[model samples]
Structures are given as C-alpha cells and as structure tokens.
Target: LEVATPAVRREAKKNRRLKIVGARGNNLKNVTAEIPLGTFTAVTGVSGGGKSTFLIETLFKAASRRIMGSREHPADHDRIEGLEFLDKVIDIDQSPIGRTPRSNPATYTGAFTPIRDWFAGLPESKARGYQPGRFSFNVKGGRCEACQGDGVIKIEMHFLPDVYVTCDVCHGKRYNRETLDVLFKGKSIADVLDMTVEEGVDFFAAVPGVRDKLETLKQVGLGYIHVGQQATTLSGGEAQRIKLAKELSRKATGKTLYILDEPTTGLHFHDVAKLLEVLHELVDQGNTVVVIEHNLEVIKTADWVLDLGPEGGDGGGELVASGTPEDIIREKRSYTGQFLRELLERRPGGKREAAE
Candidate 1:
C-alpha cells in the first residue's frame, strides 16, 4: 500500500520500531506492520501473500519518497514511522549491475582503479611512461585495437543471433602486447583480472586496498567468481551478492536500512548458510536488514518474524503471526508456523513431543 510523509517520533531507546499503519494496498487487508530497527527481520509467507506489497510497494517506496526525495508514490498506507532512524534505504535485488560485458566485479566494487594504479607504478610501466589509463581496457592506447577492449568480437548474422568469439589478436586478454609486458609479480593486468576472487585475494595480499575489496567478495560467498567476470554472465543471486559485497566494502553507517527480496534464490544449502552469516554481520554492525523470505532456514534464524499469511491470494495478506520463530511455531493458524514446527522439532536435539 501507499503512505505519505510520515510524522517522526523520536525515542530515547536504541531498538526503535518502524511501524506501518493502515497498509491496505492490493490484497493486504489493512495490515499494520511493526519492524524493529537494528535487527534481522523476515517477512515470510506462501507465494502471493503480499510480502512484496507490504515491504517494497509500501515500506520501501514510502521511505524513498520521505528519505531520498524520490517521486515514487507508496502503496495505500496511512503513515510510516521510525524513518528518522534510517539514513539510507537500499533494495538489493538480482538485476544486473551492468548489462554489458565491460562491467565486472572489480569495477563495480571500486577495486579496478587501484589495481590499475598498482600496475602503472611497476618498474616496467615507469620505463615506458605508461600511466593508469594505459592499464585500463576501456581506453585507447594500450587496449587491443581489434576488439575495442571488449576481448571479444561480436558478429551479427541475418537469421541467427549475434556471435561473440574471443579476440584473436589479444586472445581475450583485452590489452596489447606492450601493455601486458608490464607485470607485477609476473602477472599482467589482464592476468590479475582473470583470477578468481580467492586467487586475487592471495595475489594481492600485500595491497590493502585491493585485498580488502576482494576479501569482502569472498566473505559474501563469491570466492570462485572471476575478479573481472562479466556482469552479464552472473546469475540473479550472484548479482545480488555482488551488490551486497559492494555495499559491505563501503564504510558502514549503522543507520542504513537494507531490504532484500528472496536473496536465497538459486543458492545451495551451504551457500545460503554463508549468505546468512554475511547478512547477520551487517545487522551485528548495528544496521537493520529486512528480507522478503520463504526459506525456512533463513526465517528460523531471524530475530523477528512477520508471517503474512494463513493462505495466499484472496485467503491471505493478514498478519498471521509476528514474533520470534519459537513464537511462530505456537501459532496454530499459520501455515508457515506448521512447517517451521517440523523444522524446529527435527533439529538434532529437539524434542519430538514439543513438535506436537
């Protein structure tokens, strides 16, 4: 639903509540949600149970208009409170960071600039008067002229889709021979980019700027991804984590509010565990994280839960329960709680009688 400029209520408490009053948009039956600040909160339910409607359409949009001064009109809601507690609102989604192959993790996370500067400072580059610009594949001079720094040549066909083959000149290196000649520890700029996040971490261990950024990427469960892997080749979950890593690498302002929708999409069980650790780290640093989640593993570990359905569509949108996972399991009317009950009870040491 939608809300206008909400009135701010200053409180002396640390953990304040972000209350949504009268959210009646879509099938949300006048739902009023109270999300606490500085904690991990999950909005959980079956599909089409108004999770997006409550979090994105109403909360995020209203916050955007009020905080960032965006032109977005929130879904139907009366007012939102506790916005004064937040300085920033980031919706981390699966949308590509950049649509072109030219964009990669290093560039997106601000690691590429330092990497280029490091290369330019090498003795070989100094002898040739090569600058950071020379190390960049995006510019002229040092890039392979054949591919225009793309490393691949696109060929369009009349009836078939265009084809992209590695540039024969540089052999997908994207740089000229002379540029590649200047190396740090026997690896060219192209070679460094070709390394995975884990490899980059070890290669740049002495360089704080580059190492820290790559370390964050690894911390977010992306150790296997190439440092300069094209953004276009990333999955939605990968893209989302890349965005998260970029944010994490920045100086954290404890007041920022992060909203994510189904961040566990396409993630393996182990990866989900790693992703949760990173997310909890954000909250531990005193930031608030709200996720639109259906994953039981994620929801059960949340500090607070807002289960939004007794059922989906016309049968849902009302708040079935709002509490910790233990509290949710006691909710007989909640379908989520029933499943959660099984999960909680089936835990290694959980009591079988407690599940009933």
Candidate 2:
C-alpha cells in the first residue's frame, strides 16, 4: 500500500483523461493524476490533503487560463494534456450571485425578462401604456419612490446596525400604485416575486418560458425559497444551487467541464438525490462533472474516483488510488476506498462479492 509518487510522464488516452504531470502545489509532493473526461469524477481526501490546491488552484486555474483567457496564474506544474478536448471549464462555487437586495432568483435566471414582457403585453398594461421597463425595480419610472424600489427603507442607527423598515408608501411591494394596478389574473409582478418557487411554477404553468425556469429552480430543491429572496440572504449551498439551476435552463454544449467543490454541502439526503439526477443528466449529455467531496453518498455514485493521500497535512498529498469506485475499493492506501467498500457491500444482491 505504498503511495504512488508523481509520474514522470503520462500517456494520453483518447477521449478519456485530462492528464496532469508533476503537480507540485501547497503540500502536494509532486503529485500526478489523470482526471477522466465526460464522466462524474470525485476528488476525495482528508482536509488539508492538497485536494483544493491540486484540483482548483492548479488544474482548474490552468484550464481556465488556457480556455477562458483568465488572468489567474496556475500553480507550478510541469504540463497538462487534453486541454483540446474541453471547450470550457466552469467553476461553480458557493460565491454569492450578488451583494445587493436587488438581485433575486428571477433576475439571475433571466426569467424576469420574459415575465415582465408578459406583464407588459397584458391588456391592463397595454391600456395604461406601460412598457416592460416600467415593471423593473432597477429603474425609476414605475417603482416606489419612497424606498426607491427596495421595498424596505434603511434607517441609520449611528451605533447599532441599520434598521430596515418596510416602505410605508408601497407596503413593501416595490412598485408604485399605478404599476401595481396592472395585474394578470389578479396577481401583480410583485406578488409573483413574493411567491415561493414552487408556487411560481404553478402560477406560471401556462407560460412556458417563466414556468420552465421556475421548474428548474424547484428541481434543484429550492422550492421553499421566494422568487424575490435577496442573493445576500442565501447560504453558500443555496447560492451554488441557484447557479446550477441557471445553467440547467440553458442548452447544453455537451463539451463543458463543470467543477463543483463539495456540492453536497448543506444538502439533505433527498436533496442530494435530486442533485445527483441533475449532475448525471449533465454527464449523460456528454459534459464532464468533477466534484471535490467527502460525502460518501456522492463518492459512491461517481463514475471515477481520484483519491489523494494516505493521510493529511505534511504526511499526505500522494495519489493513494485512482479509477472506478470498484477499483479504488481494492486499494489499501485509500481511506475513501475503505468507506466505499462498506457502501458496495450493502448494495442489493451483494454486488461487491460478484465484482471481486
């Protein structure tokens, strides 16, 4: 069970791996690995085991610098091959979509554009000569002047935190009285934003564009969240899911490489199941998904596993094992393999025994 040292050279396999050679970053002791292409790959190891340094700082950064023309400098590595196979690399992290309250799910997903168009086309809006711009809170035309379309007015408390009070003029509706009067089926745009994603899906069922985007949100297990919920209010996991939903709504290129760091964070068992379905759909469509995760459920489902380290910190950073879950389970040096062994054993019909 001796750890595998960094390989001097790696042979490229057609349509298989994006190979790395002589990867030396952070605590990584000249680690070399091959990441499978067009498959769900998991990079699992103990904390501080150089997983992030190798994958994110080195591999992803290098790929981004090449494909995206990013200014980021990758970590020290001899070379990386198979860049030609990938069209783009997307790092879908837990970063906030926006810092202000003005950014919401509808706006982030571009669903608001179509929704406003629909509202503008309504007989009430047409008769009133209201344009699509009139429904937007970002502009000044039809939004509440009292709170400046924020729905809440900020009261400065010199020593204490600023107090946010609901706009008395529009009662937190964000729109002016005249704008609110233009409604579709007795529900205004503000009312739609206030509804949960699940509710919005049902309300806009007939509208294909809006309903499809809302359905993507619900599919990602954000059904309970309000369409108008501020981006700042969302947790890291929630923000990541929102981004995922936005990507899902678009047509797949089938050549995109999606890198997610611990996507299972803050997700419940049922939520994880929904996430897997979405991720697998991406892989099935000819896209690649690479996730850095410790969650065994996620690890077990991966088509390929790149397990780094027999330990953490200074004692680790070597490639402990690599390949399919079945292959990794046979490696003595991989702690991840030991856990996967238990999972494989518990599967119905005792599939592990037959695989042996």
Candidate 3:
C-alpha cells in the first residue's frame, strides 16, 4: 500500500483553503475560487470590475456574519466553506476615527487613558490631589475654562466665514496651569501630545505601555502626525494608517482574517513600502491578510494573486486568473496581469511561489 510521506502530509495541510463557490452577488458572475489561509492575498482589477462586490460584499460580509455574529447580511452566494479555521474577521477601512475636535489618535487607540494615568501617578500630581480624569481635555478640571478645552474660540459670523481665535486663558494649549505643572522628565502631558509620534516614541521610551503604542503609530508611516492632532485634520489615508497602527499594537490571534480595501489609495512610494512591510509582518505572524488593491507595488509582493476581469462593468466579474504574480502574467484575459507582466519582467528573481 502507498503511504503519504511527511512532506506530502505537510503540503496537504497547507493546501487547506477557504472555498467560495458559485458566488453570484452584484456584478460577480458565478465566481468560484479557493483562497489559501495564513498568506497575503491581493484581489486586483480595474474600476467597476466587481472586486469590492466579491471581496467585501461576499467574502468579508459572509465571514463577519458567520464568525463574528454580525447582524448585517452578506450578499447572495451558494456556499462558503473552510470558515471553521478562522476565529474572527476584521475589515480595516479608511473611515475617520472621530468627527469632532475632541477626538484624536491618543483617545481613539485607548493609549491616552494610560498616558493620563501615568501623569496622575506623578509625584507632583499626587501632592496636588489630581486624578486621571483631571488630565482629560474632554472634562472641566484640567482643561482651559475660556475655550472649554477646545484650545480655540469659534466666533460665528453669519454673513462671513466663522473666525476661530486662540484661547486667551491657555494660549492654544488645552490644559490649565495647574495641570501643566504636573510634569514627567520636564515634559507635561500636553507637551507630550504636541510632540510628533516619533518624538513621543522617544519621550515615552522608558514607559513600555505608552512607548509601544506610539511606536506602532511611527511604524505605520505616521511618524509626522502629532499625538494630539485633531481627528478632522487627518486625511482618509492618514485615518486608515492610524487605525492600522491601533490594530498593530494589539496581540493578534493567528486565526484572524484581516481584509483591507484599497489600502494604498493615497500612499506615496515610500509610505507604500512601509505599509507593505507591516502587512507582510502580519502574515509572518500566521494571520491571513486579504487586500483589494490596484497598486502594482502591493500586488507584486502578495503571496497569492486573484485577478478578476476580462473588462469592467457588465463585461467583468469573472475570475480570469488565480495564482502567484508570475502565474497572473501568463493570463491574456486579465488586465491586471497585462500590467504586472512588465513589472515582473523588469525585476529579476522576483517570482514567488503561489500559496497553496
């Protein structure tokens, strides 16, 4: 009798995948594909090519409802198997973390709370009978009373645009004098917020809890943004990176599936490189990362590529090619493959094996 070897058994185990068959939602025309687990996969196509309908509407939505018990309904599909391996699914999109000036990166990531606690534990803060609540700009005690912690007073001119002038009490600093007096290593809490993420990382280096979160912000290419920068001031890409950084700071479970839509929407070449590094790191940690991307830089680096096309709109939605980047280049019907051909040819020894 023929017996399977250890290598064959390992290969068989690795070949286990998430199978989606006869997915006919929106523009997706009877799509069927098997995506490997514990690998970085990219779903690429042109505008109106049904990438979102397939990945988000079908895959992510289905997974969220099944694994996460989400109330939202997924698009129509025949079957989605192999979800038993996953514990949860997270969709990281480019939505703003906050709508008001009161919301900032520190507050969104829960890092500000610990930072405030650290400030409250300071020797000066203890002598002054201050608590963690006193360090918050959202509250009354530590914040400037004149501007009500807004740092700027908005004067509404009905006929003309609103005029926003600096706060007279704190001079644009949100905190009052007493709160500012509580310093750690010669820098107050407000001062720390004013510093860039890179500066904050260095400033809080001795404090692991605060330093690690700040370091994540820097790692995700947000080193230039201030810790206390207004949430409204950030662009879509910046907000997404902030969210990415927040997620990165957490201890990830290996069974989690991360789905990102157009992660490289507004990223520059350098920033894209940083983003790719972080994404691959996630996959390295045994988590599956699926991205709906058009950037060749991102697509080429993926362990597996699922190219959906032939044309956009009515003519598209079929899976034209599915394999490694090199395998994609061989498919004539795939527009993404046509573009990737040039990239793959130019870079010597860039061919990677497709994830099973």
Please list the C-alpha lDDT of all candidates, in the order they appear.
Answer: 0.86, 0.85, 0.84
lDDT of 2 at 271: 83
User: What are the per-residue Cα lDDT tens digits for candidate 2 across 1-356?
Assistant: 11111112122235567988999988888988988777788899888888999899999999999999998899999999988888889999999989777888899998899999999999998988999999999999989988888888888899997777888999989999899888888899899989999999999989998999999999988999999987767988888889999988889887788999999888778888778778867776678889999988777777788998878999888888898788899999888999889877765431111010
Q: Over 4 Å off in model 2, which ranges?
A: 1-14, 155-163, 349-356
lDDT of 1: 0.86
How many steric clashes between backbone atoms does each model show? Answer: 6, 0, 0
Expressed as tens digits, the lDDT of each residue in 112-139 for candidate 3 is 9889999999989899999999999988
lDDT-sorted candidate list, best first: 1, 2, 3
lDDT of 2 at 185: 84
TM-scores of all candidate predictions against the true structure = 0.92, 0.92, 0.91
lDDT of 1 at 149: 87
Worst 10 residues of 3 by lDDT: 1-10
lDDT tens digits, residues 107-223, model 1?
999999999999989888899999999988889999999998888888889799777788999998999999989889989999998999999999999999999999999999999
> Candidate 1 regions off by >4 Å?
1-15, 157-162, 346-356
Alpha carbon lDDT of residue 73, candidate 3?
79
- Candidate 3 Cα misplacement greater than 4 A, ranges: 1-13, 153-165, 350-356
Error of 2 at 173 (Å): 0.9
